[model samples]
Target: MPDSPKEEVDETGGPDLISFADMPDRLEAAGLTRISKQRCRQLAEEDPAWPVPLDKALKVGRMRLFDWRVLEPYFRNRTPRQGQRTDLKPPATEA
Candidate 1:
């Protein structure tokens, strides 16, 4: 099986794995839709809301506050992808 995340600590005391809670701010930050804490608490009750889907949305809007110190490294200075044709090419026609 694949190794556990860095945040996981085994009895052997190996390298600590990275966890969502310990992740950097940028990675933990929101993506597009922003949400409020009150809304997050509500979403937390729903499926696919609390962990990332909701958090990312709220983070993008810059609403929920977080400790970026550990989460910062996870994020990067990245720009949105260009709207280029990424579709797979169809098989070429025989001559």
Candidate 2:
């Protein structure tokens, strides 16, 4: 089957732009990280390394589209946050 409009690459020969709503599933389906829409939003808002959205200034809708090219690497190389590690032992208290 032919690709849909949503799947077409842009003139820059880059991957199709995607919204946060579909990003998590798309990345997960591609064997990347298992992320949520809320996490995507948080990363976009808090992560300095996040790619700038192509339509950041457009206020017409709540949809913010990002470039897949940049995001793919980000997700592929993402490491777990330090606070998420479970191997650390609690500090001993001196009596």
Q: Largest TM-score belongs to which candidate?
A: 2
Error of 2 at 86 (Å): 13
Ten-residue stretch with the least lDDT total in model 1? 70-79
TM-score of 2: 0.63
lDDT of each: 0.38, 0.73
For candidate 2, the lDDT comes to 0.73
Per candidate, the number of residue pairs that clash is 16, 0
How do the predictions measure up, each by TM-score?
0.21, 0.63
Q: Which candidate is the best by lDDT?
A: 2
Clashes of 2: 0
- List runs of model 2 lying over 4 Å from the truth: 1-15, 53-60, 82-95
- Candidate 1: tens digits of C-alpha lDDT, residues 15-60: 3333333333224343533334443344334534133443443252
